[model samples]
Target: MNIKKENDKEDNENVEVFDEILDKSFIESYDPSIIVENQVTTETNYGDFQHLGCYIICVLIIYEFLLLLLMGNITFLIFGAAVPNVIGCIGENKNYTFTENGCIKLYEIQKNESCIPIIENQFESIQSEYNLYCKEAENVKQTSAFLQMFAMMIGATFGGQLSDNFGRVKTIKYSLFFIIICCFLSSYATTIEVFNIYRFLGSIFVGTKSSVLHVLLLEYLPKQHRVWVSTIFSFSPNYIIFSFMAYYTKNWRDLMFVISFIGLIGLILINFVKEPVRWLIQKGKLSKARQSMIFIEKWSGKLTDNMEKKIFDYIEEESFKQEESQRRKKSYTFKHLFVTWKLTSYSLFFGYSALVGCFINYALIFNLEKVSGSIFMNTAYLGLIRWFFNISVGILDYYVKWFGRKTCHTLAMVTIILTLSIVLLNIYFPLQQQYIVRFATLFAISMCSQIFIANSVAQTELFPTSIRNIAVSFQAVFARLGSIVAPFLFGFQSYSLTLPYLIMVTMSIVDLTTIWILIPETKGDKLKDHLPNKDEWIFGKKNRELKLLKKVELEKKYGSRCN
Candidate 1:
């Protein structure tokens, strides 16, 4: 028994020596930045649960739904269905002798002393008020939409710079305030010119608020949960809400007033949300970051004292690094996006994808007016389809590990390409079944919407914290360009029904090629918080490989505990 006990003791001592040597080896090659990043990753994983995550998500949903009311389903529903000539008649030769189908002869016309031409409408609209049925005024509708998109493009770029330089929270609040003001003014405008001007201005604020909100939400959430939260939040319920509101509200002015009121509600709700700790740390606001961490700890019941200590240790270390670099700290702008070849490649591919996606999606929407159906029903169908696909994609992203970001993206592109091809077939074969045509178009749009959210989460994952907001906003600029061009593309249908779809297919092919060639798979990867170093910037491989290896070593040493 004594001999056996001695042998067991010797075995235990040898095991300890091995562990000590392994730890020493790890310590010698330790990178403080990597350790800090891992600590943050762990903390965020824990932070994904409890009251804090729920609260933030609720606030974001409200913000998105409210903004969508102003610019999404509601705006499209009102404008797309507002034509006076759809159900009524514009009289011929300054006489009210025209029937719903055609102009009647003088013998069939009702007797009248003064035969002045009158325009009749099913509902009050800009088309009725401004006499937009004439060829001279037809372009005005397209011009209004184009101006709004152009303004949004400008706003997105401006918001990115403002958010990075100032702060996300500040930018959101200010943008909301301005949006409310613009909506209110739009509701009371006496002239079409004034109404359009207010709408253009309001769209700018909407774009700003949207871009900053995305960055803020992503920064607050964990990597795994971000896909779902970002995707699901984008699933706007406003389409259903707008359908009911438009059914009851006949006047466009009343609709505008209601949208403005919703904007006010959003402004009030934004105060309950907090700034992201990651953003605060990146900006070197350690005190604020510490306070935010304490707030998180208070709400998160699962967090332990040890976890809290490790988190603060990371903050302390980061503070030292920030102080060391404070004197040489430079502010990032849109121009920095082109400074490196890697960045330039990412920017070009992503921007083109955004542009193409917006063009195809909105072009389909604008073409809805030509589809033979109730406009309200078409809008409702699209809204429901988008909601269904958004949830489905979100669930897939959250649950399916193998069906990753790039896979989801590629699948969406394929779906779009195939559906657009079907649209082309319908154009050539001339489908007699209108419902079949509607379904194909809606399906294509649903897939486009899926791509919209997927690209958002994927791009956010790609860019670092320093320029993340601006990079996203730059994509928004391209998306707005697509939106701006959609009206003009739809105009080509007047010349050739197949022209627009052909262009869209060509663009989708280009986008798919860019995706495989330029974009990297970013799933199961750590979120980079800083720009690449000199070596990594030039070669684009060294730092990432080194950091990844260190992560593996740490994970192995910790075993399941790290997971």
Candidate 2:
């Protein structure tokens, strides 16, 4: 209807229609077509919600991750806290007294023994407290470590399933609760068996929470924020800080007591949080999903009394995706990951990259001892560089998107391989001591480790929300295997000083090959934008103009005019 008349003298622009559509009375009439038709064009669409609720929830998740990473690192720190306690074991070897039962080793006795001076610091360690030394020392350490790893594997698999089966928000909250309880108990463990048991149980929740953290971050963040958050969350910069504290405090139990309270931060946030809207919808909890959608509107500063109808319209006409009857019914399990081609490839490449990354990193650490400067300062140098890299990655990720993920990772791996080759050369042909500066060579090698942080962002982008945690968790299992193998590579140092370096170069080449072939360029992709053959309308704001335009034509044909 060209209702404008010559006498009316209209401006060609239709300003009145927008004002009328946006008006309170027009909105209250509840004819969905009025908004639906104009929603395609002529402006003043549904409340202009930004869905900022995701960010609000993501902040809490990030805090949770930071605390968990710090605590995980602390587990290693605490284990080594009482190395000085071995002085007693060294001294006890001198006492060779024969008794009827057995040779009783006595403490504080002046047995004629040559010994290195022991530091008199009052560091109370689990080793000192449990007397895990001499005959059983290696057994104690290896057994306790095995228990934790075994439990962690169980926890990782269980946690993935739990997160997928339950919900991200719920799994995080409940898992953290268990962490607090187990951590507190572990701190007070009075015996070796008790301590190992405590550690094993705590690892379950720790491993579970670890798997859930990245999934939660990606699920709640927008595409842009995910890029930044994924980059930031991928590395733990707090290791140095925890190391300093553990060094000065001289008591691990006290440090652990402090870590237990870390989960309290997440506990507070989880109470008022909403699960990811995509997750809710996928699980068919339509009511809760709609509630979360409204929360998103409110959190994004787009509240409207008319939100009820809008949410319903979104669920019925937009967010709700009904699968075809001919399609196979599938459950959310690890098996789906194998069947999905893109997902399978992503998992394989992600696992391989992580494996090689861990392998190269640990191999560097194991063989780093032969470098010139003080080993402590050299290590501190490495850690500080890594910390700086982690912080800078958030900024670096902006540039990474331009090159594409595959290119970025390939370049990084190649660069590190070159760095390794140079370091190996320096090992055989020692750089002149007077000519070399402090930490110069060490700095070159250490800085290349940033590839792990840079690639971590791409790693997160590779998985879908439905099984993201599963993919990441299982991939980490491979990475853990690499870490285990890395220590053994130190034996290469016995064969040749540069043997580990050669092996690391090989691993880097393998990483580059895997990345080049398997990983798709995930640059500028929204989370899970690579899903294969998605025929259903997913809940996102993009493409709404075309969708609304197509629907409005059907409305007009059906004679459902809002006017």
For model 2, how does the per-residue alpha-carbon lDDT over 251-343 read when each residue is reduced to its tens digit?
Answer: 768767766766566577667767877677556676787777777776666668787676777666433243431143355566656645566
Expressed as tens digits, the lDDT of each residue in 1-563 for candidate 1 is 99999999976765565466456584465554543333533433223322335455565666574556445422543443355543332344443445453213322332533333355554566666666653333466677778777888888878888988788888988988898898889878888888889888888887787678777877777777777766666634566667666656666777777777777787887777677777788888888887777777665544678867866787777888789779759998887777568888998888998998888887777656455566667767877887887777778877888877778778888888898898799877987885887788878877777777778777887888889998999998998889888868966867897888899889988888888888888876667777765323434444444444555566677797867
Best by TM-score: 1
Clashes of each: 0, 0
Candidate 1 Cα lDDT to native: 0.71
> Candidate 2 — which residues are off by over 4 angstroms?
1-75, 78-147, 304-311, 318-320, 323-328, 362-384, 399-401, 432-456, 491-497, 529-563
**TM-score on alpha carbons, each prediction:** 0.80, 0.69
Model 1 root mean square deviation, Cα atoms: 11.5
Candidate 1 local lDDT, residue 460:
82
**Model 1 weakest lDDT span, ten residues long:** 101-110
lDDT of each: 0.71, 0.58
Tell me the lDDT of model 2 at 401: 58
